[model samples]
Target chain A: MTEPTAVIHDIGYRHYDGVRLGRGRATLALGVQSLRGVFGFGRTTRAKIMPLLLMAIMLMPTVVSIGVMALAKQFIMPYPGYAVFMQAVIAVFLAAQSPYLVAPDLRFRVLPLYLSRPLTVTDYVVAKLAALAVALFGLLAVPITIQFVGELLVDLPGPPHTADYLGALGGAVLYAVLLSSVGIALASFTPRRGLGVAVVIAFYMFTAAVSTLFYAVLSSTGRDDVAPWALILNPFFLVDTVQSALFGTAPINDEGYPPGIAACLILLAVIALAVTGVLLRYRKAAS
Target chain B: MTASATPCFATEGLTKRFPRVTALDDLTVAAGTGVTGLVGANGAGKSTLIKILLGLLPPTSGRASVLGLDTATQGLEIRRAVGYMPEHDCLPPDISATEFVVHMAQMSGLPRTAARERAADTLRHVGLDEERYRPMGGYSTGMRQRVKLAQALVHDPRLVFLDEPTNGLDPQGRDDMLALIRRVGTEFGIDVLVTSHLLGELERVCDHVIVIDGGRLLRSSAIREFTRAEQTIAVEVEEGQRRLAERLAALGETVAAQGRLLTVQVSADDPGRTHDAVRDAVCDLGLSLLRLEQRRGRIEDVFKEPVA
Candidate 1:
C-alpha cells in the first residue's frame, strides 16, 4: 500500500537523464571556445578579417625561406629568428585579438551566467589565459613546423639542427606564456571592446618605444655597463634575452644581455605577476 | 511538487550591506517548489538575493541554501542544480543562437553530442524557428529573449531564477512569455522563481507570490489566496454611471464610484438580489450597460488593502 512510485505522476517535462559533468569538463569547454574565438572560428565574416590578415602576413617570411630551401639544401632563417623578425606582427595580432576574447563578456555582462554554473572565477581565468597562450603558440609554431618539415625533406638532419629546432619551439612557448598573460591582464580592465583594443595597442607601443630609447641613450652616454638592462622593459626583448641565454642563440636587441639564470628568473617573475593579476580581475568581476 | 520536504531555497537572517546602502536587510524567507514570484522594485535587492543564493556573492551576515546545499560552502553543488538567466544582454553578437546555446550547454558539463541535441530541443521549445541558425546580432528582442531562456533551460536544472524576463516586451510578447513560464513549471515539472517589478504581470503564471519592498519581505502566500473572489460587483455603463451609483445608494446599497466605474457591495444574506438591483438600476436610468462582473482580488491589494 505504501508504493510511492504508484502515486507519482509522469509529466511531459523532459529531464536530463544523462551524466552531468563537473568543473574540469566545463573549464575545458570554455578554454576550447575561447581558443576558437581567437582564430575567428564560428564567427561572422567581418570578425574573421583582422586575424586572417595578420596570420597571412606572419607567414610571408616562411614562404620565402621555404622557397629558397627548395633551390638549395640550406636553411636560411632559424625558427626563433622568424619570431624575432615578426615580433611586430605577433604584437599586433595579440593587440587586435585579446580584447575580442575578454571584452565582450565584460561589456555584455556575461560573467553572471558563467559564474552561475559549476565554474569558479579561478577556473575562468585559467581557461582564458591558457586559451590565449595556446592561440599565440599556434601562431608562432605553425611556421616553425612547416620549416621543420621542409628541412626533413631536404636532408638537413643533424644533432645541431634537431637541437636548434627544439630550442626554437621552447622559445615560442616562452613568448606565448609571457605575451598572453600580460595581454589578457591588461585587456580585462575595460568593458568597452574599443577601449580594450586601444589600451592593449597603447601598452605595446609605449613599452617598445621607451625600451628602445633607453637602450640607445644608455649606450650613447657611455653607460654601456647598464644598457643591456634597458631591454627588459619590453616584452619581446625580455623574451629574447632569456632565449639567448637558455638556448645559446643570439640576443635580438642587445649583444651583452644578462646571464641565462637571471633572465630566466625575471621571465618567470613577470609571468607569475601577470597571472596573479588576471585571477584578481575575475574575482572582482564575479563578485 | 516533488516530496523533498525541504523548501527550494531558504535564507535566514540574510543581510547585505554595501558602502552607500543596505541591499538586503535582515530578510528571512523560504520558497517552496512550483512557480514562485519575487515581486519588488528595481532597487529592492532581488538581483542581490539571486547572486548570494548562486554563491557568487557572500552576504554580509546570514546563511542561505539552495536545493538543500549551503550557498557559501557548497556553491558549486548549488549551482550545479540551479539555473540563472541574467537581466541584462549577455549573448555575443556574432555567434548564431544555436552555436551559443550549444556551447553554453557544454559549459554546464553536458557531453558535446548531448549538448547539441538538448540545445536543439530547447531552442524549439522556446519557439525559435529556422531563424535560430542566424547570428544573434540580427535577432529581434523577442528572439534574443528566447535564446536567453533556451540557454537557461538547456541544462535542465531542478530550479531556475528568471530576473525580469518580461521587462522589455510588448503586451502580446508579455502574454506569450507568461504562458511560456507557466508551461516551464506545469508541463516541464521544473521549479521556477521569476521576478517582476510590476505587480500583476506574474499572477497568471506563478502558483505562489512573495512581495518585498525596500529590501524587506511584506508577504508570502499562495497566489490563489492573494487573488480570491470578493463580495463586490464591478459595473461599468456607457453613460449615466454616476446616476446609477446615486440610484443604488438611494436603494440602501453601499456603492462607491471609482472613476467612470462603480463598485457595489452586496449583503451576505441576499447576493442575487443585489445583482438584480444593479441590472434594474442600469435599465431605469436608460444607460447601456457595458460590463457587469464579480471582481477578483489582485496582488496589488496585498500592499494596498492590508495597511489601509
Candidate 2:
C-alpha cells in the first residue's frame, strides 16, 4: 500500500510557518550586521585609503607649525599654540569628510539592505555614527600624535603633566564624536549626497561667520578686552575654549569659559537629541 | 504529505501606503517549497510586497510572516531566516564579491573562518568564479546580479526573495539568471519568491504563480493549474488544400482558418479526442501534418477583457 501522507492534496498545507522572535536578540544580530557592514572585511580598504590621504594632507599644517617652532625657536605666530592648531585641523577634517562617509548609504539605497536584515533604524544610525567617529578619530589622532612627538622632542617647557596629554586627547575625541554625530544627523535629513555635504559645510561656515561678526561688533565697540562668548555655539570655537582652559592660556572671556560649562553640556545634549530625532525619522521613513 | 504542507512564506491581508499612493493594497499570498513567481506590472506592488515580507516596510494593515515569523513584529528574526535580493543595484562599487559576501555572512553570525569559506562556496554557486575578486564597479549587469544572489545565499537562509532578478539583463543573461533562480529553489532546496513583470518567463520556472494588478491579487495558483485547462489547438499542415478543413468541419470540429493554420477548440475533458479527430482528418485528406499542439494561454491573456 502507498503511504497515506503521499496522497494528500490540501491547499492550506502550503501556508508558511508564523514564528516570532525576541526583539533583543534580533537587535543584537542586526547590530552586528550593520557594524560589520561599516568595519568588517574588505569594505574598509577604500575607507582606510581615503582617510590616509586626508590625514596626509591635514598633516601639512602640523608639520609646518612644528618646523617653525623648532627652527625659528619662537612662538611668534599669532595662531594661539599647538593645541589650537591641532583642534582646528580636527574641526576642518570633520567638517569636510563627515558627509562623504554617511551620505552615500542613503543616496545609493544601501540602507534598505541593512533594514531588510535584523537591524533597526536606530542601530543603523549608531553604527554609522560610530564608524564616522572612529574614522575621524583615526585621521585626527595621527597628526595630533605627530605633533605630540615633536613637542616632546623639542623639550617644550611645561610641568610635564600626564593629565594634560590625556585631557587633550579626551577633548579631541569628545569633539570628534560630537561633530560626527552632528554630521550624520544633518546628512540624514536629505537623501542627496551633495545637498547633505553642502548643508554640513554651510552649517560650519555659518557658525564661523556669525562668530566673526560677533567679534567684529565687540571690537568695533571698543570692548577688546571682552571675547565674544557666544562663539561657543560653534563647535570649533567650543573646542578652542576647552583647549585654552586645559593649556592655561589667557581666558578668551572674563567667564574663563565661553558659554560656560553649561554650553558644553548643552551641545552634547543637543547632539544626542538630534541623533535620536534623526534616527526616529529614519525609522519612520524606512518603514 | 502535501507538497504545500510546509510553506516557506505567507502573507495575509498585507497593506502598505505611501504618502501619495497605496503601494500595497490588502495583498495576501502564500508559497510552498520551491520557486513562486510574483508577476505584476510596474507599480503593481511587487516591490512593496517583497519589502514588507523582508521586514523593510511595515504594512499599513494586516500581516506577513516569512519563515513563520510575523514580519511587522518579529521582522528581525524573520530577516535572519530569510534572504533577499533587491531589484536595485545597491552594492558598493569598490567592494569585491568575495569580500562583500563574506562580510554579509559574518553579519549573519557566521564565524570569520566559516564566513569566508561559505562566501567562496556561495559565490561559486552563483557562477562568480575568478571575477569574484574584482571590484563590483567593473562587473556587468549579469555578473552583478549573480553577486547579489550570492550575498543573499551566503548565510544559507532557508527562503530567498529575488526581486526582478532578471531585470536589465540581455537575453542570454536573462536565461542564465532564470536557470540560476530555478536551481536555487530546486537543486539547492532553498525556497524562492522571485518577482518579475515578464509573465511568460516566470511561467517556465515557477512552481506556483501569483499575479497582482493595481496592488491587488488577480490570481494565485500552481503553474500547471493555470495552464492545464483545455484550450485552442494550433494545427499546421504543409498542404491541406481546402479538403481537410471541409472534412473536419463536416465532422463538427469548429475550425477557424488563419493564414496557414487552423485553430480548433477542444473541450476540457476531451482534448485527446479533438487531437485524434484532427490527425485522422489530415491523414484521410492526404495532407502532410507539419505541426499540431495545444495553444498555451499566456499570462497576458488574463489582462484582456471579453466584450459583451
lDDT of 2 by residue, B208-287 (tens): 88888888888888887655542678888888547777887888877878788787877567677878889889877888
TM-score, cand. 2 vs. native = 0.78
Q: Supply DockQ values for each candidate.
A: 0.69, 0.22
Q: In CAPRI terms, where does candidate 1 land?
A: medium
What local lDDT score does residue B127 receive in model 2, on the 0 to 100 scale? Answer: 86
RMSD of each: 5.6, 8.3
Model 1 scores a TM of 0.90
Instruction: Give TM-score values for chain A, per-prediction.
Output: 0.92, 0.70
lDDT tens readout by residue for model 1, B163-222: 999979997888889899999988888899999986677777988888887778888878
Q: Which is the leading candidate under DockQ? A: 1
How accurate locally is residue A5 in candidate 2, as Cα lDDT from 0 to 100? 69
How does the DockQ of candidate 1 come out?
A: 0.69
